[model samples]
Target: MALVHHDPQDGILITRIGQAEITVRPEPPASASGAPVILLRVDAPMLDTLAAAYLDPDEARRLAQALVHAAEAVRPATPWRSPRPNTR
Candidate 1:
């Protein structure tokens, strides 16, 4: 299985596949009412690619917020850790 790593500080998830790496991050919506978007960037020794997708705003917000929380959780004690993790 490929190893996956998360860097909450940068709001990114990375997966290593063979010799290539895939990175995922959230991108701001293009329109007020449009769905949230997730951007994907793939990099290999010889090539690179980029892609994105729009998803349900509610769901996206939940996910994005979760990631931000995760990023905070991994940090040393600080003010941002007061809030508990979401359970939904």
Candidate 2:
């Protein structure tokens, strides 16, 4: 599980994944609408691996889109519910 923390003092968002923790500062207001301002801090090794895995930008985008679709498909629609009794 990942932990997310919002700091009002610094206006920074911190996300802790496993043992790794990263802080991102949001961009100043007045940019494009609904654009993500914060940037995630990733180590060089991890960045290199990610780059190598998807050498082509187009392929990477395709893979990411596919992953999102697959993730949505596997997610449960709602909380587990027992089946209703069958009518005669």
Candidate 3:
């Protein structure tokens, strides 16, 4: 969970994934009031070939909306909560 790149101007934060390190960067909104975009990139060091997949703002929002609806549709009657931490 290390930060590989942080572009303040573009408002991009690229974080190192796991051992293989598939980068995940969330791009800032196209406009001030627009939704954010998500970018998944594979570096040459790991993949031997560079690749990238971008989820545009519109698509990202649509996916998120659908996910929320799906969750709501399949939600259980019992609400889920985190367990309390054990104090020594």
Candidate ranking (lDDT, best to worst): 1, 3, 2
Worst 10-residue lDDT window for candidate 1 reads 48-57
* Per-residue alpha-carbon lDDT of candidate 3 for residues 11-56, written as tens digits (9 for 90 to 100): 5666665544556568678789987778867665555677887898
Candidate 2 segments exceeding 4 Å error = 7-12, 29-36, 43-70, 77-88
Model 3 residue runs over 4 Å out of place are 7-9, 18-38, 62-79, 82-88
Q: Judged by lDDT relative to the true structure, which candidate is superior, 2 or 3?
A: 3
Q: Write the per-residue lDDT of candidate 2 for residues 13-82, one digit (tens) a residue.
A: 6666655565555454345654434443533444343211212345546755887767766784567644
Clashing pairs for model 3 are none
On lDDT, the candidate that comes out on top is: 1
Instruction: Give lDDT: candidate 3, residue 25.
Output: 63
- Compared with the true structure, all predictions reach lDDT values of 0.70, 0.53, 0.69
Could you tell me the lDDT of residue 83 within candidate 2? 72
- Which stretches of candidate 1 lie above 4 Å from their native place? 1-5, 8-11, 47-88
Assess candidate 1 and give its TM-score to the true structure: 0.38
